[model samples]
Target: MTDPVDLFVIGGGVNGAGIARDAAGRGLSVILCEKDDLAQGTSSRSGKLVHGGLRYLEYYEFRLVREALIEREVLLNAAPHIIWPMRFVLPHSPDDRPAWLVRLGLFFYDHLGGRRKLPGTRTLDLRRDPEGAPIKDAYSKGFEYSDCWVDDARLVVLNAVDAAARGAEVLTRTACVSARRDGGLWRIEMRDGATGAMRTVTARALVNAAGPWVTDIIGRVTGTNSARNVRLVKGSHLIVQKFWDGPQAYLVQNTDKRVIFINPYEDDKALIGTTDIPYDGAPEKVVADEDEIAYLLAAVNRYFKVQLRSDDVLESFSGVRPLYDDGQGNPSAVTRDYVFDLDTGGGGEGGDGAPLLNVFGGKITTFRKLAEHALDRLGGRFPAMGNAWTSGAPLPGGDLPGADVPAFLNTLRTEYPWLPRKLAGHYTRLYGTRTREILGNAADLGDLGRQFGPLLFEAEAKFLRRTEWATCAEDVLRRRTKHALHMTKAERAAFADWFDNAAASHRREAAS
Candidate 1:
C-alpha cells in the first residue's frame, strides 16, 4: 500500500521529535516512531542543561558555543515551565586553569550571544561570599556564570505533543524495523514492541534520529551504509539528597580537565554526573559502574566541604551519546555538533532516489536549531514548505502573559489556596498554564480522587493518561513526573497496580 506521509522519522528522542514537529509545522505530513516510550533513551538521561559548552572554549568550538549560548535564552522563553535560567558557581582551582583564563571564558560567555534576560557572570571571593559557604575553605576564589536547566524528557514529550497537535502522528513503543525505497517514496515497516504487531507506512523521505542507535538503524534497520560512523560515548549520573543551600548549581573542574555538574534536582535532591568513557557495548545495557560513581563522588568530594559517599547515592543512570566519529580518539574531545548524511538512492535502488537523512551527534540544548537545520538540509526536497517559525513560538503551555512565570505562580497560589503548598507549587512548576486543565473544577483534596502517595493523586494520573498519552505507571511516575524518586517502594508498587488495573478496565469499557 502507498504511504500517506511525507516524512517517516525514526526515534522519539529530542532530535526526532523536534524534527517531526518542525516538519509538520512546515506543512509536511509526518509520522514519528519510537522503539520504546518517549525519551526512553539518552534524551532523558542528559545533564539537563541548555548551555553553551563552557569548556568547549578550550577546543575553539566558537560556532557551537555561540549557537548553543543563544539557544539557552531562546529555549527558556519557549518553555518557561520546563526550562529556566540558572547560576553556576565554579570554585577557582589555581592548580588548574588560571583565574585570568576563567574570567576570559566567562566574559565571552556573557556577551557571546544576545543574552538579554539572563544575568551576566560575576567573580566571587569564596572566603567572604555567601555562595562560597558550601565549598571547602581551601578554595577562597571562584566565578559564577549562567546557564539554563531543562526537563530533558519533558522537552521530548512537549515536542511530540506539539507535533501531534499540529496533525502529525507520534507512535511511541513502535520501532521502525525496516526501510526500503519503493518508487519515488520510501516504504517503512514498524513493529509494536508491546503487541508484536506489525504495520507498514509509506513516506516520501525517512529520517534516522535514533541517538545512540543511529548507526544501528542505518545498517541493521535501513540496510544502508554511510561513510560516517557513530562513536558511542557512555556517560552516567548519580542522584542524592541536596547537600548545599540555594538554587545555584556548582560546576567542579576535575583534574582530568573534565567538568562535573552538581545541580539541585526535584526540590530536595541534587543531580550529579557524568564521566566520558568510550563504549563498544550495546546502549540498552549501559549502566553506571562502581568506578564511574566513585569517580563522580570523588569529583564532588574534592570541591565541596561535605563529601559525597556511596551511601549518599539515591539513584543512578547511564546513557550512550551517539557522537559522530570524527576520527577523534578521545571520547571527551569528540565534536558535539550533528552531521546529516543524506542518501539519495545510489545503491540497490538503481541510480538516484528518495532522500534518507541520518542525524548524528547533537546535544539537548541544540535540538530545536538542529531540527530546523535538518529541514533546511531537506530544502531541496520541499522548497514550498514554510519558513522557520519555531524560534519565536512557545512550546505547549509556555505562553504565559508576558512570559512572566513569577507573576503566574503568584496568581496560581491565590486561585488554588485550598491545594497544599508543595502540591500547588509542583503543579505550577510542571504544568505552568496547563495546571488548570488538570485541576479542572476540583473544589478540595477530596475532588482529586484517591491519593496514592504524597503527590501521586488520581486526578494527576488521569490527566497524564488522558492528555499526555501515559498508558503505563512508570511513564507517569518516572518520565511524565518525578513521583517515583520521591515515592516509597511500596507506594510505587501500589500506584503501579492501580494504574494498570485502571487502564485495563477503561479499555474494556471503551471496547464494549
Candidate 2:
C-alpha cells in the first residue's frame, strides 16, 4: 500500500521548501521531493539579497517593492545567522540618472515601506568618503542605502529542516515520475535516482513549486496544462577576490542603465553580478558566457578605480529565472513578481477534483510571504488548518537572545574556546545554535573526525547529512557550506572521493 500524506510538494527550491515548512507546521502530513540536491536550482544562484528591487520601483510596482522591503527585516530577524544588514553604495553618474532623481527615488525607497530595523538612506560625498575612494574621479556623489544579504542555499536547507522538524518527509535525489488523482487524493510514483527503486505514495493535495521546471512538471510530469507560461530569463554572477576594504557593497550604474552589485563575500572575496538575457536553453545548461562575463566586468570597471579584467574572475555561475510570461520585450524589463495558476482541472484522466497550484516568478526576499499566500490560496479546502505563524516565529536557531548576533557569538565562543575564532565565526554565521550540536562533546580540533579543508571538518559534513539532508560532496561544500571555494582542486577531489565512500557506507548501514 502506498503511504499517504496531506501535502505533496514537488521541487526543493526555496519556494517548495518554504511551502513544505509552512504546510508541515500547520499540521499537514507533507512529503517534499527533489530531483537533485536542494537549492541546486535558481534558489542557490540568486544575487543573495533580501531587499526590495530598487529598479522595480521605477516600474510603479510599489506594492511589490513595499512588501519586499518589509520582508527584508522579517527575514533578517527570523534568520539572523544567515541574513544580515548590508549598506549599498550607489555612485552617482550624471549622464545616466540625475542626482535629484536618484535622491527622489531613494527618498521614496526609504519611506515607501515599513522601515523598522534597517537604517535609512544617506548621502555620500564621493571625494571625501572612503566608499568613493574606489570609484573613478569622474563620479562626485553617491547614496548609501540599507538592505539584507542572505545565504540563499542555507535558507532552503533551513526551511527543509524546519519542515522535517515539523514532521514533513523530505526526499532528496528522488524524482516524481507521475502523479494521478485517485478520488480526492493524489497517487504519486517517485523514482530514487541512486538505487533505481520506486515508491508509491498518496497525497491529498499537490504543490507545483518546481521553479524552472514548473511548466515541465505541470505538462510533462503531471499530464496537465496551464494557461500561464513561464518565461525563462537567465541571470549570471561572478566571484572574485576582495579588492577593496570595508564591508559595504557597491551598486554601480552602467552606461546601458543596468546596475551591477559588488558585494563582500566569504570573508575575503567579492561577489559581482548579474546580466538579464533571454534564455531558451535548459536550466542545467545555464552558465556564465564570455560575453556575459565581459559585460559584468565592464559594468564594474566603469565606476571603480580598479580596472576589472576577465582574468580576475575566480568563478562564475548562472541561473534561469522562471518568470511568468507577461509579453515583456526586454528580459531585464520582465517582472520579478510571482503569480499563482491554480487549476482545479479534472484530475489526471480520472476526473477527480484535485487542484494543482503552479508557482511562477518569485524572489528569495519574500519566500515566507509567498508560502503563506500559496497556503491561503488553498485554505478554503482546509479550513481546519492553523492561521499564519511564520512572521513571529524564528527560523531554526535564529532565536538568539534579543536577536543580537554578537552576544550569541560571544556565548558560542565561550562554550568552544578551543575552536579558532575564524572557524567559530563561520560556524556561528552558518549554523547558529546548531553549532553546538555539530560540536557535541568535542574538546578540541582533533575531535572533529577528519580535516578535509580549511574550516571543513567531517563532523560538520556528517551533521549536514544527518540533519540538513546533504547527500553528496558538492551538496556539502557548495550548498550546505562554501568550503569548496576555499579548498584546492586536489582537496576538493579528495573530499569528493571520501564523501562518496562515506555516503555508500551510510546507505549500507541504513539498509541493514
Question: What are the per-model numbers of colliding residue pairs?
Answer: 1, 0
Among all windows of 10 consecutive residues in model 1, the one with the lowest summed lDDT is: 345-354
Tens-place lDDT digits, model 1, residues 98-187? 989999999998888888998899999999999999999999999998899999988999899999999899898887889998888888
Off by over 4 Å in 1: 347-352
Q: List the residue pairs that clash in candidate 1.
A: 3-202
Q: Rate the local accuracy (lDDT) of all candidates.
A: 0.90, 0.90
RMSD of each: 1.6, 1.8
Q: Per-residue lDDT for 85-153 in model 2, tens only?
A: 999999999899888988898888888777988899999999999988888899989999999999999
**Residue 418 Cα positional deviation in candidate 1, in Å, after optimal superposition:** 1.3
Clashing pairs in 2: none
Q: How close is candidate 1 to the true structure, as a TM-score?
A: 0.98
Count of backbone collisions within predicted model 2: 0
